[model samples]
Target: MGGAFVAAALLARLGGRIGLPTIPLFILAGILLGPNTPGFVLVADPHDLEMLSALGLVLLLFYLGLEFHMDDLKQGGRRMALAGGTYLLLNVGAGLAFGFLTGWGTREALVLAGVLGISSSAIVTKILVDLGRVGSPETKPILGIIVVEDVFLAVYLAILQPLLSGTNGPGDAALKAAKALAFLLLLAAAARYGTKIIGRLFDTRDNELLVISFLGAAVLVAGVSEWFGVADAIGAFMVGLMLGSTTSAKRIMTLVHPLRDAFGAIFFFAFGLSIDPGDLPSVAGPVAIAVALTIVMNVLAGLATAKMYDFGRGPAGRVATTLLARGEFALILATMAASAGLNPRLSPFIAGYVLVLAVLGPLAAGRSDWLARVRPGEPQPELVGAGK
Candidate 1:
């Protein structure tokens, strides 16, 4: 594991020098080193690596939530909600249509919709950082879309877990959905209202105390989320949101950066670790089909979202390309589907789609400006440099 991290760090540095994103490089390394690649740096116990990968996911989301600012939310206001809602309907609809056309059953189609709809928040957030786009005007709405996406994801899982367990009927599924929705509402309320106590807890400049407090809070919240059957990444994100409401958000962000980088790499690598190379070629056709459809829909989603919100072409392109990748959540859906025996072929299809998109997604986002300008007779907009 230690060697894995060291190798990941070296790969990341090399990728950086070549203007490549680390998200794909990390996963590519995992593929090269995973158990599937016998005689390589094989992960002997993938189950154990998965547990740590879960941790990596939690911390990665926590750090992302920390990057969001209240000002952005407040400033973007209603446009964020409108854009996010529209984006969801469009993308999810595209997924469902694709699934049905491919002859999947209703439930399987819905699962496929989920696999295609959600963007890789961890990878996308990392792209924002690597491209120095965090504080940009376009980012506010993108983050808003992510917030909405997470909420929908929780609801999807609420219904999915029971669906996999074989719910008695639609009413039973509705009840579970209600419970999940209630939990999400309560979690939001707590984060929104419980700022004073949290603010005072680590208001002092004691590095040791602050570190312990933040880490412990993340763990406690994530553990509680697991207890409630919610995704731990969502739980950690909420914790980060609560912390973001406080004055110490900046301090926490600075402190958490190093940890996020290290663990985040592991998270991406572990994602690749779970893939079975033998299963991929068989599913390549479906993977390519899904990827092609998603790319078109994602671009449309971004364009429509930006136009509706009155954003410029530059921002619209950013939204479209940034969303081209699907990641951890999609894998979770695939894993659950495989375990429930829904379809023997779903997992490989998803893994291949996600793996390909992770690489293409970042590259697309990094060059969004150029992609947007590919339109005839349209002059490309100038990119504002970082910190400008």
Candidate 2:
């Protein structure tokens, strides 16, 4: 753990000096020091970091929830839905079409649809914080789209399970989907009506006790969520949401910063450790095309979101680029594919595609102004809190 911390921090610091995002640098540190590459191996087994990495993911989303107030939800409710729906229609539809074009078969197409469709909530949350855009005008929609995708993921995975696992029947798939829906609704209800009750539960002045209560609740809820077949990250987020409305929200957020930063770095590092650079080459061409497709689709989606919210080019670019990274969830799909014995190339394609965008997402977001400058257009009204 010490070695992982040192390596990640050192690389991130070095990269920070050069104006690079710490995210990709942390991943690069893992790739360079991991056993997959020829060099000093800091950690021979990525599994050693798995639990910590999962905690990192949980904490990241939990922090995101803390920042996303209910007022934002009420204000952007309809527009958020429309923006999220537009994003899904463009990206998921394109992914399915691209999957079929690859001629990898139906199962592969189904998997690819998810891989290409969902944005990495973990990465997106990190970008929002790193770029200081968490409070930006477009962030509400960006997060709303992520929430929408989480719901879609539950249903998509339910559909994919029977086809891939062979053991799960349509009945099993329906049950899983139902469980996911129930879990989300349960969380939503808690966030809506149980805020005061939740506040009372964690209302304490002791710093140590406060940390223990919130951390335990977040992780426990996240674990329960996974058992119920929903994304653990979503579970963590909802936990944060419920707690964010509490009187202790500010205190909890203050305490969580260090934990979120530390664990989040490990999450990215573990992600890099799992990927073998050699595998990326074989699927480079396909990955390139897929990355291009994601970028183009995201741009269209961003424009649609901008139009809906009356945002100008800068905010639209920020919207597109901020949501660009694909990480943990894509890897989850890759693991499922490998276990199901689908196309072998699918794994590498996902790896290469994720790595490129993971790196590119932060880089692009940092320079979103460049996107705004593309083909200079007529002056437009800028939305409040939308500037870079």
Q: Find the candidate with the highest TM-score and give its number.
A: 1
Which ranges in model 2 have alpha carbons more than 4 Å from their true place? 103-111, 120-167, 310-315, 327-347, 366-388
So what's the TM-score on candidate 2? 0.83
Query: What is the C-alpha local distance difference test score of candidate 1?
Result: 0.76
Model 1 error, position 131 (Å): 4.4
RMSD of each: 3.5, 3.7
lDDT of 2 at 371: 66
Expressed as tens digits, the lDDT of each residue in 268-363 for candidate 1 is 787677667788899888888889988888877888777776666677778888878788778767756765678666766777888789888888
Model 2 residue 341 distance off true place after TM-score fit, in angstroms: 6.9
Question: Could you give candidate 2's per-residue lDDT for residues 146-239 as a string of tens digits?
Answer: 8777656655664565467544676876777677778778888999999999999999999999999999999999988877766677789889
